[model samples]
Target: MSDPAPRIVRRETHSPRSTAAVIVALCLAVVIAWVATEGVLSLLGLPALLLSPRGMLTSVAGAPDASAASVIAVAVAAGLVGVVLLAIALLPGRRARRPLHAEHAIVVADDTMLASALARTAARTAAVSADAVSVSLGRRTATVRIVPVSGTRVDRDAVRGAVTEEFTRAAPTRPARVSVLVSPAGKVGS
Candidate 1:
């Protein structure tokens, strides 16, 4: 009997590559179109709407005669822009995403949902109201903020344990360190 084919799992997080590339492509297209329009107008012996290609070349050729400070500033600006684009192209852009491992398939959960779940788990474990707990999940850490009710003490260690357990149950590929923060000021009446 033939063995089953291996399944390929796609674990890519959100990246700005497509958006950046599209924006750069559109900008280049606009410049090329403008130059083509100017060339065609010159050929037809019509009045140029803007500077002609020859005029642009002449200005560029005479740019060295301009003030040294202005030329240096322009060159530095262009170099900085080039470096930024190169960094964007080479660096891997990663976003915060929660993925739950399942037997049959992986379920992707929204960041807000993950945060809410962690908050709820911590609140329930700490014997507090839902509104008393808040969670913020980052790339490598999940911070659980708790505002205790007046005259009540919240166990930070307990809350941290519960939140950590719940997060571990989710089984994300990239695990985050769970941290519980108890507010110094307690809320009134709740």
Candidate 2:
């Protein structure tokens, strides 16, 4: 008898943060539209409750000059805004792990989930409690730290091998180098 085909799962690429950006952009667009409409109405001598660009400039011209404190405050606010925009532009937007490229479609899993699986594998292999294992996943590395039970010695090499084997089986898109560190202190409750 022939074996059946493997099932394929789709990966989601949407970022939750992108929704906040879209809503902010829509709000800004609405405010810009209102300002433009008001400006046009003022130009045509229609009744416009909102101030137009020209009216705003004329008001500023007739107003008293800004004090030193006010000028410094405005400069500080502008600097803060610039910093925020720069961070938004430079920071990595996606939180999803690298996608596993397949023949038909790509598959992706959360880094935390993959780390948890590797931790479980290591714990089982080391004969230690799951809580004794800690896994940290980086872009190109997976660090597994293990704490053995009190008065019990653990084979670091065996735990490392098991962790690396589990990571390989998981098959993350980008292969990560596995590093295992055995803590000096062990938990009393195992």
Candidate 3:
């Protein structure tokens, strides 16, 4: 029998670059639209919305002579904005997601779903209700919070072992460190 071809998946994470770019484009468009409107109004001998294009150009041309400090400040602020936009475009954005190891298929798991599964497994192993267990899955850590039922003893080791085993079996590309937290007080009727 021939082996199945492995599936190729592009592990692309969500990024804020597109949103930022759109915001920037919209802002620029608004500014351009305002300028064009003002210019047309001024040419047509109509009252300016805020300032006529001729007056705006004159003020901009004379801005440097108004105050050297203000000019420098504006230049610095513009430069900082440019740098920030550049960094946003160049830096990689990450999400709370990881790829699971599979033989011939690609599988990505969200952190929330992964946490739920781990919590369910831990809860089942501890013989407690699902609500008794809470899991917080982070980029490099998975914290399990367990609240035992009243008058029932919960073994932290067993819960930890079960969660660890489940996590290992799932085999995420980036494995998270597991930490179990057992509440000192047990909940009643849980």
The whole-model C-alpha lDDT of candidate 1 against the native structure comes to 0.83
Candidate 2 lDDT for residue 157: 87
Candidate 3 lDDT at 126 equals: 88
Q: 62-175 in candidate 1: lDDT tens per residue?
A: 998989999999999999989999999998676666567777765767778889999999999878899999899887799999888877888889888888888888855667
Off by over 4 Å in 3: 1-12, 58-87
List model 2 lDDT by residue over 1-190, tens digit each.
5432222232243244566578768988999898889888988888876777787888678545767787788789989977876677666556656454456555677888888899999899889999999999887788999999888888878888888877776674457788888888888875
Local error of candidate 3 at 53, Å? 2.3
Give the TM-scores of the predictions, in the order they appear.
Answer: 0.87, 0.65, 0.76
Prediction RMSDs, each to the true structure: 3.1, 6.2, 4.4
Query: What lDDT score goes with residue 56 in model 3?
Result: 94
How many residue pairs clash in all the candidates, one count each?
Answer: 0, 0, 0
Whole-model lDDT values for every prediction: 0.83, 0.76, 0.83
